[model samples]
Target: MSSTTSNIKFNRRDFLRTSSLAGGGLLIGFNLFTACKPNAKPPVDLADLNYKDFNAFIKIAKNGAVTIFSPNPEIGQGVKTSMPMIIAEELDVAWDNVYVQQGDLDTENYTRQVAGGSQSIRFGWDALRQTGATAKQMLLNAAAAKWGVDVNELSVSEGIISNKAGETLGYGDVVEEAALLEVPGEVTLKDPKDYKIIGTDRKNVDIDKITTGKPLFGIDYKTEGMVYASVLRPPAFGQELESYDASDAKAVPGVIDVIEIGDKAKKLLAGEKVNWTAQLSPSAKVVVIAENTWAAMEGKKAVKAQWKFASPPESTEFHDKKLTELLDGKEFTTLRKDGDVQKAFAQADKVIERTYESPFLPHNCMEPMNFFAHVTDEKIHLVGPVQTPEDAANTVAELLGRDVADIHLEMTRMGGGFGRRLYGDFVYEAAEIADTLRKPVKMVSSREDDMTTGVYRPAIKYRIKAAIKNGELTGYYLKEAAINGNMYGLIPNFFPAGAVENYQVDVAKYDSNITTGAWRAPYTNFLAYAEQSFFDELAEEMGADKVQLRLDLLEKVKGTTDERIQYSPERMQGVIKKVVEKSGWGKQPEGTYQGFVAYYCHNTHVAEVADVQLENGVPVVKKVTCVVDCGIVVNPLGALNQIEGGIIDGIGHSMYGNYAFKEGMPEAKNYDRYRLIRMKEAPKVETYFMENELSPTGLGEPTLPPAGGAVANAIKAATGKRVYKQPFIQYDEIWKVAEKPVLG
Candidate 1:
């Protein structure tokens, strides 16, 4: 099928100024390079070319080699390879001949360049495709003009254009001519059936570099004469740095300087909106600058600092009590109201009320937070792994009192983000240190610092209640108590909203000194478990099959509400049936306990069935079958990797991940104390994708929400006990304690 976009120009000036490559935005005109070098020839190799500011999409060489710049940060989401594949597919280039490059931070040319929210591919789909198609159309025009034939009479495949007379020419031979030709007002896109590179498996473009231990991640970044900085911040959330003595730190070998960094919260709180609040570490910090990282770390440890309580500190116990009190109380903002929830609950024959709680989760990105900054009078050069380079640049610009244009930000491949790198505090810290000293500085965080001084997934409690009447599901109410925010923004219009007649979502929040932000799937990561587990109990109470009950509710969802439901009931049911078939849902062999879950989030629908077995009376997740409906798969290999990764990550975290605070300080400051899913405990994941022609949605986060729910339910099936709190291992510990008490 043909796709059309607005006319645009390809001149370097216009490309940089107006940013004709802006995705999902209107293009006003169509023009070509009017002042192209008189005898410009495609370079023989990559090194011979000049770096142009505006080759924002695809660039070609005389040997038919193509380089497509991926415009989003690569946080291991595979967009660095997958995004360029979209451009190559429509550019009619062979995958083998295409090279992928990470694009620099060019806010003028790229929209939504941030890597969080799993939106890079979803948001880039249309524009990336159009860019390649536009380039191809121009190439076709050049070929047609040379062959004296209509463009329609020529067909191209793998970067070679063939005329009706059987004469063929490489795209490189016509690229010079194409560069001077006017861009088409609109270009026809390839039909999905004809796509070759998009659906096919392609290895990550940097897999070799990554596997061979190349300098790809932020921690690997270095430069000549660049000093290292290690910082010591407040020990607790509400603490204020009083004074610091850096005499011993300065005397340490290779230690250069120790300086105090002041707080920016007062400036931020003065009615100045500076994008997502960059003062997560708002308290004062002492920075130890040294010739090398070892010296910096040692120097930081030697520094003597004092802190005072500025406010009442918080603890996990306090949070638990406050959340329970909020749930019991009636002070809540109604996020969504579908019908008379109170009346339906009052009229119900049976009401199943369950509260699910999850603790604060650290992103624990494999790479600790680090950034390199060189702040000179003329310009600021910042390099690091960040999910939001644009925001980082802007924030640093504001912090350093420099122009955003003066700040040049480059993104390195991240070890892992999981939503932690979305915040630019680390970037700001590096910039601040460099600006303060007027020297190039690379700020590095120890694993302890990364864990204790990081923005976390808010600790949340979900109280889900279901009303049943005459063996029919009647009402649903979800009340959420979060540390600082609510799930109203993400899941208010999701499933059961349209399915139940009396449905309502209420949210209440407790303000705390502890910082919380997005973590992977955010609220739905744990919410799915709460709602789905409740559904299972609801099913058992009604004496109905779990999968069939979900399907029945989905069936009732048709034409029920005017609000835009985020999920398609048909798609939700499709994955549910597929997972059931793939998992052999009810027919599992003896000793194999299976649980099912279906959920929709991040614009995708997913279903997961978990298989659990008892090992020494301890429930062990043996395997999981996941079925997803995220529309057309871009790359089956990448999609499978993501699905398997999400399942394992979800299962591992649900089973063992835990983070807590005591008196406003994180209890676990390093890996030795913090728990993560180990490789031995990871479940074998069997994945399936629903075949469809619909446009692709997000995959990175959608598959995660259902995994916890499926595993939790399976554990319940295995042990005949309900687990309402996260880090299911706690229950095992409790069981061990209870079993040994009398024996002793």
Candidate 2:
């Protein structure tokens, strides 16, 4: 891991300049593209308090209190904390003095304010560092000018500047002068080794709010003269609203109005290009508006609605059979083909193949889908917990036939996203409801509503085959069959691509009415389990250690066509080796079954080992060791929280999470039916971060992919039975005869 710095040049006109606050303070604005341009007018005039002019920003009060605006949505990924930490670190400010505030959607200043793909930290790194560095440089120059000393002779630490003569000044004392100084042309970034706040542990800035149940989540949003809306969506995926009688709903106490809103499909099917985010807006649904949430919910329950199939209804059974048939058929698209796989398999000594299957899954975010919208003739104001606020605003704008400039979106903390909030359909629906009533409305989705009528993780099947020749691995082929969509765009270039000489990847998809989109790591979530489990079997067939087998394959990938690879082989190997040493792989005590898996995705490399103990013949995950190489963790505490959360989430869903559809209706409406990992079942996680100078990648998703694989392998070691399907309890025989699990 090497440290790299951007040599950004900034002229007086293009530098990230400062402004005098309404109060006696300094407000610094940073824009990576235009703010640091060589020759251009500054994006924002340094005379006013205009916040929309910069992608990243810092405000220092005269009393030394610092406020940093986090430009990305905070979906429990800790960006609100980590993003500001970067600025505070470079600003040489005390961590205690820093206050982080979530910034509203300002496309004029921000780029990539999205929360998906685990890229918030990676993409915001350089600009955020430069923002603080630029501010600090200006402050240093101000102190130098006042003290009649060279800037190079001044040293600053935690908002205090000192000279060799022992004279000291607080940053507050010089902030006014700093605001008036011209921005430096170039600013130097601190070396990674000199970092103080980045590598050290820092608590989430919102931890207190979250734990204390403050009004930080979108579900907690409220406004005056606002009505609550509960919707009645079509029960089935292919169903369309035909007629609705709101007589009973209107009779309910506190009920105000019931209205039907048409789906965006009309515009979507017009054969005209429309906003992609708006395409996910809901189908025809009856909205019940009332004075309160309880009234709205009750009114919705009382409403009588009639639905008819727009097309053929789909079921899990139909999807499973169709996907299986697609796997056996010749109709497929070649995503990637490295060599002649057919020829390599022709003369093979042995061929092994396996198919893995997973059911569709709902996100089931803790805070059920909800958004507040105020629609008037002039503007549309939306406030919610959305991952892509910019996209949400655009989607609303498109759906309402309004200009994007007239839509303003504010982001509140999300209880959980897990890729669910990436779509702006809910936001659009809220705006539609409010626009129809010409008033402010807060739309809420019941747990059942979201579970049954929501964007889901598409059900998928993978057929993976490997051909061996003379004890050497020769060919590898993977065929993916999915409902609605295929693997993610970049997955074809992931692991085992550059490692195999005759590697090939093919995919086929069934266009179903069931809506599907990104779910956490997306395709890699289950693909990792399928591929890593297959690799374990491949290693066994080759009479090699599973861990060593991965290392050997990575060795072949290193330096050979490395540029095309999405992940670093060295980083992958580093985590693998670290997890092995830390977990004492192959040296576990008696009755302990250990499984190892290494994976790379979300621009991060991770290796995990699950330790299983059979409790009354049922495999119990007792502990897990996870080693990550995300590089220069901005906040070790937050990073640890993400790793543990990812692993636990992965294990929970892989073990008991099963959402089935029968005749286009979700089997489980809520947690009463859907199973989740219990507190007693959670494994004690030992987390370790591979120290490196490389820029940080993503931690929110990468660790999750390997968790399922490691746990499944551990169960196999414990029971000599392999599980190929998600919700492992359904496929493994040990779970069939085992008594109720009891915590050890």
Candidate 3:
């Protein structure tokens, strides 16, 4: 086990799997993986799972079946499949017979089991591989003892051990004895060349269940005597629940109870040393409990409540307007600075300055936020689709004045997280309602409720000023503006920041009551669009190919002795060259204009090219070619799928995604106003990975950063205009002019 996981107190529940491991079958648990930080949400699973001693991983059955328990929640990133592939490959097990199951929330047994930030494969690599290798050695010892022969004289293949004379025993036949042997702290792992299941394309563990209409998502979860619960929220931010009239809701048919969640939470935490890090209660809400989902929803529609909203500061009418005005305000912080930027600009032949903006976006998970809770006087049992089970359990414990040990958390295969479920506010609400009703309850957020009261992707505005001297880049200056002016999961001095001679970066803030958090790649989500698109424009000014310009920059940065430089310029150049060659950078078919972009994050590099055309004045992206270098591809098929999906998600969100606030309320109520890329709008995407022996990184997000820029640059190519803002809404007019949008 790693030193960090040792901090968690291991309880018996975590070690319970071991009992089954050494019993009828062999179950081997290895070190827990604690990859997530203490307080990160939004694309990082911060679910404070509080289970103990679950550090073990693999189990072998007497029937020659192998079961692998994946501790991390599967949010459609393929962790459940890829993590086990690592173990099976090292263990030399038959891939066909390996079975995978989702492990319960056991922070002590599993470190940082949340599934955000695409950290699953990267963090679990060493631990999971050791698990398989260690178990294999134990089994070898058992076989050697039975045969009274040296372990080295025995050869194993696909769960069977045999001597040169053909004396053999199945792995299952010796697994019982192996379980009693002491675990080796060190074991030999398989060479990548020897891997048969890893690099090969493998099916998802839940593909059969998913394709055949099995219950896998939180919405599909159910329990006996569990009534459906729903809530009605306050109208805007900074509002409080004064009083509620539940008579009408309770009168509705099938409605069991209409309770004020604030009152319930108050009672649950009454007079106790309870201080949950976050606000456990909703902004201002009322809960409806009923026999079923339909009844709960109907009852919620019938409910009404009075709200007392304290007046907020600032003359806030429209978000874009107020934010734009505040961009020039004095409240700003410097994040990075370099050589004399003003001198470089003064010496430049030409200078260009522009600002780019991206609006708040809802996660819009396919399954709306939902969780099931059964809160009793003694214990709390929670099960649902949450990104951060550990974080959630800890928060619930604080909210209810209970010990972390008394709260049990479990996660289902998520419909989608995209960082929304990380907060587990919905779980707190469910637990509170269940405690009040004294029955098991499942809480479901309506699309309106989920969208309106969400911790949205913070609306951000970025301004860049560049100085080009004699056809070469000279200086770069950037000032980012947001609700808090905080950059999330993205480094201000990453990539080109160190590559430039004179560079400076600053941040400006305009505080607001609306909550904001990470979405996808966070700052990189928009940073790539702004920086890469700007680079494309610069490439045109220098009469150079966009792809070659980036390569040239990487070539220059490689020899520089800048103390701030972090990435390997060689790796960056490698990905760029491979993508250019595969995409035929300047050699696309007639009328197929192509846009190209490259970015590095989470220790993975990706370059993308979107081939597009003008279809009825709207840009129709026909195809996208992508090249990835994420280190040794654990599951080739899975990695490719993630890259493809990320490209589509990036394009979809950048082009059609936008949200706004008017009078402290969300203007985009649901998908009807907010947009997502549909199948007809999706481009045919192709993915290819670089062959390397380096350790693997997660692929859930690397491809996303560059996609929006590729599509935008492609749009620029086809229409000869730049989109300075997101949600390229007006198809005809967007290409006619490039100007800062007028804030209403």
Could you say which candidate leads in lDDT? 2
Tens digits of per-residue lDDT, candidate 1, 633-718, equal 89889999898988888887887788889988998888777778778988888988999877787888888888888988887787
- TM-score, prediction 2: 0.94
Mind giving the per-residue lDDT tens digits that candidate 3 earns over 376-398?
A: 88899999998778777876787
Q: Candidate 3's C-alpha lDDT?
A: 0.77
> How close is every model to the real structure, measured as TM-score?
0.92, 0.94, 0.91
Runs in model 1 lying further than 4 Å from the true structure? 1-56, 263-271, 731-744
lDDT of 2 by residue, 1-744 (tens): 323354665665444345657677887775665533345222111112111223787888898889998888899999999989999998999999898988899887676677777776776677788889888989999999999999999999999999989999888889998877777767778888888898899999998988898999989998999999998988988888889899999999999999987655357446354454554533578999999999999999999999999888888999999999999999999988988899988989989999998889999899999999999999989999998787677667777788999988889999899988877778877888888899899999999888988889999999999999888789999999999874446667888889889999999999999988778887799999999999998988888889988999999988875555778889899999999999999999999999999998878899999999987677789999999999888999999999999999999988877888999888889877777888999999999889878778888998898999999889878877788888876532323544343111
**Candidate 1: 10-residue stretch with minimal lDDT:** 44-53
lDDT (C-alpha) at residue 602 in model 1: 80
Better of 1 and 2 by lDDT: 2
Worst 10 residues of 3 by lDDT: 1-10
How far in Å is the alpha carbon of 629 misplaced in model 3? Answer: 0.5
